[model samples]
Target: MTEALLELKDVYISYLGVEAVRGVSLRVTERDFVTVIGANGAGKSSVFNAISGLVKPAKGEIWFNGERIDRLTPPQIAGRGVIQVPEGRKIFPLLTVKENLMVGAFMQRDKKKIAENFENVYRLFPALKERPTAKGIRLSGGQQQMLAIGRAMMANPKMILLDEPSLGLSPIFCQQLSRQLKALHNEGKTLLLVEQNARMGLSLANYGYVLENGELRKEGTSAQLLNDDEVKRAYLGV
Candidate 1:
């Protein structure tokens, strides 16, 4: 079997005295698009936070490319090529569109590579290029979402963790973003996405996991879960 590019083993996390992620285990193989879907308080963001080193796992192991990373700092984790585009489009409100993207490449020193990455991100999201001088706060919701994704891409990550990529966009924008994510997958970017939109998440993902009350409730191929009656009733409203 191929080695997993990223793996979580019996991961647990807590805030104060409350456990947020309870013995969660998952894996992302190289270039695979995987998703975790759950209700509002099901610990999706906590899982991403632990993996990105924003919060250390209380009792489990996080491994990336065969190396243990649970004890690393956030910057250290990011430097190792695991990047996250957090929820709520956390762009610098005062920064220009171009500047916000440049922030994502801060760890790199190669000016030429940075410039190339900037150009590539602009090509991927021309709306950003057109408004390069605009402050991040001035962009629309959908544009901001695009900028968030573009910024993460600037890191040239081996795998990206995305939280709620379509949170507040219109239906059309959600579809468009989903297609872009699929394109990214085809181009060999491994992804671990957390989404509330179950249908869209499962449709785009190759493998899917369900989280409930901070624990893994189900796991399967996207197709299998999409058609499961319980999933449809709970997440799809069918």
Candidate 2:
């Protein structure tokens, strides 16, 4: 088995006397594309929040690349090469497309390296290159989502936490996003994706975890979960 690049052990998170995640343990192997699929309010985003250091866990541990990270600040975590593309495509609407991408490089000091990353991002999404001066608010929803992913990539992350990348996209756009995600995975980027679109998520991932009410209900190879009767009935509506 491949060594784990990211691991959570018996993690618990709470907010205002309510527990959002309860004793959840999971792992993502190096360079693996892993997906977490669950119903809304199942605490999937809460898990990502904790991973990104946006929410502190009340109990347990988070490990990345053999070091503990649960106590780190969000910027600290990003500095350690863990980045997130949050839900809702939270692009800076008032900023130009290039400026918004530049925000991702706040931690880096090497201007030349940052410029190289920007060029790579523009290469990946040529539409952004064509509209570098366009305000983010003027882009289509799909373009905004692309910008979000591109922004995260600009951080030079070792592992990216993606939350609902296909949430509001049409089928064609979702398919396009899935293809891009697969391409990233093929290039050996580790990914931990939380997605509501079970069919697409499972199809792209090598391993899959099912979360329900903040608890990890099941986990296995993607093919196993995809063929499982209970998983199909509950999540895939098969």
Candidate 3:
């Protein structure tokens, strides 16, 4: 078996005195596409935050590329190429499209590599290429989402943690976003996505885990989850 590129071993997270995640252990092998699906308050984002070092875990360990990362700072984790494309399409409203992408390449010192990253991002997102100088705020919601992923790509991440990437998009845009995500996976970039839209998440992933009330409730290949009656009723609305 391939070694896990990212692993959470009995990870626990709390806010103030309350626990948000309870012993959530999982793994993402290199080049794997994994998704965590759950309802609101299911500790999905908590898991992502812990991995990104936005919040310290109260217990357990997070490892990336064979190194411990739970104790690292957010910037330190990011510097290791574990980039996150956060929810709400958090692009800089004041920055132009190209500038926003440049911000993600902050850690890279190689001009040639940075230039190549820019070229790759533009190729993947022609809409962004068409409006390189447009302010982020001027783009539509879908366009903004594209910019967010493109920006993450600029960092040349080994694994990307995407939180609710399709949250508020229109159906058409959601379909487009799904295609883009598949393309990224095909390009051999490992991904861990946290999404409330279970059907969409499962469809996009090869493997999936279900989180409920701060704990893992179920996990399987995407096909298994899709066929499981409990998951269908609880998440698929079938």
Candidate 4:
């Protein structure tokens, strides 16, 4: 059996004594594309934050590459090749697209690697390459989202945790983003995505977990979840 690349073992997150993530657990294996789909305030972002070390889980272990990482600092966790494209496309509004991408490589000192990653990101999102000098705040919504993904790519992450990558976008842009993500997965990148777009999430990921009220409600292959009447009614809009 292949070992999981990322594992959250009954993780819990609390904010001001309010439970944000309630004993959520899941796994992402090498080259696997996994997703969690739920409505807003379902604690999906909290789970992503815990995996990235932004919010320490009040309990349970976060394991990455077979090591305990719940205790690691955000920077330390980042250095381990787990990167997140946070919700809201949190690009630096004042910075140029190029500048924002460079920020992703704060831990990297090698100019050669940085340059290589620049090419990689540009290849992934050609629109960003054309607007390198443009400020992040000026890009259209789709472009901003692309820039956010490009910026995260600059980190050369081994696995990416995407939070709502398709939020607030035109249908065309969402389609474009989906193709880009599928290409990444095809290239052997491991991904764990959280989204409220259940149809897109299930269509794109190989496996999925349904989150409701901060809890893992279901786990199955994409097709299985898509065919489930309960999931269909609540999330997929069948």
TM-score of each: 0.98, 0.97, 0.99, 0.98
lDDT of 4: 0.92
* Cα error, candidate 2, residue 32 (Å): 0.9
Q: Model 1: number of clashes?
A: 0
What tens digits encode model 1's per-residue C-alpha lDDT throughout 68-165?
99999999899999999999989988999989998988887989888988987887788899999999999999899889988998898999999999
Q: Cα deviation in Å at residue 154, candidate 1? A: 1.0
Count clashing residue pairs per candidate. 0, 0, 0, 0
Best by TM-score: 3
lDDT by residue (tens digit), candidate 4, 1-238: 6799999999989999998889999999988999999999999999999999999999999999989999999999999999999999999999999999999988889999999999988988999989899999999999998888887888989999899999999999999999999988886788889999999999999999999999999999999999999999999777
In candidate 3, what residue range of length 10 has the lowest lDDT sum? 117-126
Q: What lDDT does candidate 4 reach at residue 169?
A: 95
- lDDT agreement with native, every candidate: 0.93, 0.92, 0.95, 0.92
Range of the 10 consecutive residues with the lowest summed lDDT in candidate 2? 119-128
Give the C-alpha lDDT of model 2. 0.92
Model 2: per-residue Cα lDDT over 34-135, one tens digit each = 999999999999999999899999999999999999999998999999999999999999999998999988877989989999988887778899999999
RMSD of each: 0.9, 1.0, 0.7, 0.9
